[model samples]
Target: MTTRTSRRAGGRQARQALRAAPLAKETRPVRAGLEGGAYKPLTQAGMERIHQAALDALEQIGLADAPQSGIEIMTRAGAILGDDGRLRFPRALVEDMLAKAAKNITLHGRDPQHDMNLSGTRVHYGTAGAAVHMVDVDGREYRDSTVQDLHDAARIADQLDNIHFLQRPMVCRDIPDNRDMDLNSIYACVAGTTKHIGTSFTEPDFVDDGIELLHMMAGGEDKWRARPFVSNSNCFVVPPMKFATESCEVMEKVIAAGMPVLLLSAGMSTATAPPTLAGTIVQAVAECLAGVVYVNAIKPGHPAIFGTWPFVVDLRSGAMSGGSGEQALLAAGCSQMHQFYGLPGGAASGFSDAKLPDMQAGWEQMCSNVMAGLSGLNMVYEAAGMHASLLGFCHESLILGDDIIGQALRCVRGIEVTEDAVDLDLMRSVCLGGPGHYLGEDQTLSLMQTEYVYPTLGDRTSPKEWAEVGKPDLVQAAKTRKETILAETSRAHLDPIVDQAIRARFNIHLPR
Candidate 1:
């Protein structure tokens, strides 16, 4: 009896020690840019049909409201300016641009360790949205999201391993001027994290200022161009085939500055787009293909993400249902379209219609995120920290989302069938000569960290153990973690002198 107790206790100690040990980046069970594509929501024939329909839409329906400059550039690239002023694309022209568009693009980070190599079926997840309200989880209420809230969110995200990139998730509603709001958004995100960032400019004139701020952050314009870590998430097209004129101009300037562009086509189904899911995807594809032509025309082989963000709406109420199963299918189907075009693409997922990160939010966020990762989306935006159908952002939810994405990424990794993995010798030996079980096997201990993922806040204790630990609530635990992260000062921000210079030159909103 004594020997058996000692053996069990020793086994427990070994596992605890192993759990506390640091793992090399390569050995971690989940990480950025894991290969996916195992899930095919669209068949090859269906994808081919969608492609043809999109091409036909471009050739016949075309897109209206292109800026005069866009008209000139695309017209030169073989797009015909119709009598009604819509820019119609020739099938040959789209094909040429598709061939000319940049592939296997890299989104650089201020730190080299965070750079993402976007190629093949490599999948990366991150946060992206413009929620105006911040969910106060403790209060169970929403309030205006301030610049400080944005900064805090970024800092919290910087420490999360599963959040690969940090986009401006919430707006600076405290700032009154549009230009200051845009510039401050950049400052807050860049100052908080060294990961790759995605943001948008409100006006074309603001592009130069935004670039100047980036140059300052990068130490110089030449150096910034060498490793442009920020990307412009431009909503270049409105739903149902129309161009957003101001955003188009902003795209041109950002491209000239050598920053990557995300050609975002966000249409609301059953409202801005067709009611059918297939038709919604076709419109989004056609619109983004037009954007592809526009981008390549401005600069041959520019890096642009095919952002097909088609939103779903509840038919009865005409409200956005970002957490519905239909939303998951829309994102997954769009990922298939991105693969079909052979372009680095991104789509929206992980949003929750729930007011808080509760049971409904858990299922909603997980369903779409898992589907998006499995479908091999090159970039999965809004994969964390969005709630209230994207009207609210929650910091505690963002912290909780890290754990959720870890599990989702594990699913993306799927099963590996190596010779060693399937070997029966170890099993045979364990059953025959070893103790009746493999609990203390050397191989079992070694594979603990690599073969499985353990969540940071997920409870895996028995009911008795849970009582001993005070039965910690998940949301409260996340809240505590959020506070702990924001309490510590980060070393990733710019040096004091550089920050002072930036404050002097630009209207920096967040306090020092």
Candidate 2:
């Protein structure tokens, strides 16, 4: 009995020690930099105004024909329908539903073992939707992607630090069957890489397959259900319209299965809706809300992200150009609408119609990136490497995008608040004699590292020094950075048996 008692005491001591030790440090802080500075905290009055605007648009003009189920739901909820199949949503009902939606959520990645926290100060980055081009290692460009290209792209994305999510499609590849192709692509990516995945497919069975793979990686179905691999299921809403049957079915499955989905609506001004930005925005909001209502109807607390990539149709060329000032305005409005629902907003800022990485690309990317970041979208998709109006993705463009995203993240970080940051006392002491000397001061040397962000790409050296080293352009610098990163960093290895099983299932031999 005495021996057992002593053993129990020792066990208690061990447990206590374990509890005392610090938890394994999170890879990054949950909330870094300034608190709540990045977000524009909306007041109750502002929400009411936005809500009223949405209602006015719905009631005055009414929305166009949505899916049959969507029409039925709106009718049941006392939303008025016109002869033209326009829907007029009840303001009260809209407000009530919006009140119940979850504003903040953490999206799980390839590993159910880890997730990207979205609330508070935490920010996650990813590329934008559906592109058709890819750039190779030897500066060669290829269009219309294949499975092999996707695999290599996933491998490269897995090795990047700033890129935290896989947005699918190195290029749309051909498989034996469409459903099988979707499943194989998703499986290949989740199995081969460690980053969070963002994918969208048209088939329910394909979704089920992707979800099953997520389950396997998560160790169980329940774990997978609790924190799913985040995906942005795209559904095209007919202009000034409602959801389609296929879209409704997809949204229902996602909700029923308790998976997070982003309701993406790409409304074009003048072509899809009205020519004016505000009118187009109101129309887009109604369409997005209609989607939200669908998801919420299927499951009251289903995880849904509100997204819009609205652009104006160029009157001259009839092309979908990405960098118009109107696009930025639409993005800001989308952010407001998401905020109204207390849901996370999704938008992309860095995209261009320029065919190459030139001034047009730089300006467009920078403008969009800044607008999206300032608008306070929770997840900024296409924050990197998009060109030719989002028709292409280049290796060099991606590297440049990393630097741009880092800059945007730094902007959101705002100003740091600490004794060292303020340095009131130190400044007073050093400046009391009127702009004297701080270079020789011990405090200056001690604090410089924490105060500055040393650039990985931007040139900080003198012009003379830069010229001596050949004065490389940003593209060359980006290329050099990508090469160095690929050479120096190693991809994280997965469990050997799991890896083998995945490859075997796909009937693809593992590269030696």
lDDT: which candidate is best?
1
In angstroms, the error of model 1 at 81 is 0.4
TM-score computed on alpha carbons, candidate 1: 0.98
Q: Rate the local accuracy (lDDT) of all candidates.
A: 0.93, 0.63
Name the lDDT of candidate 1. 0.93
Model 1 sits at a Cα RMSD from the real structure of 1.1
Maximum-TM-score candidate: 1
Stretches of candidate 1 exceeding 4 Å from the true structure: 1-7
Model 1 collision count: 0
Q: For residues 321-341, what per-residue lDDT tens digits would candidate 2 score against the true structure?
A: 787766666665666556656
Off by over 4 Å in 2: 1-50, 57-88, 110-114, 119-123, 135-142, 159-161, 174-176, 416-424, 428-435, 440-449, 483-494, 506-512
Superposed by TM-score, candidate 2 places the C-alpha of residue 323 at a distance from the truth, in angstroms, of 2.3
Model 1: per-residue Cα lDDT over 1-512, one tens digit each: 67657767788888889999999988999999999999988899999999999999999989999999999999998999989999999999999999999887999999989999888789999999999999998899999999999899889889999999988999999998999999999999998999999999999999999999999999999999999999999999988899999999999999999999999999999999999999999999999999999999999888899999999999889889999999999999999999898899999999899999999999999999999999999899998899999999999999999999999999999999999889998899878865677666677888889999999998999999999989999999999998898888974789899999999999998889
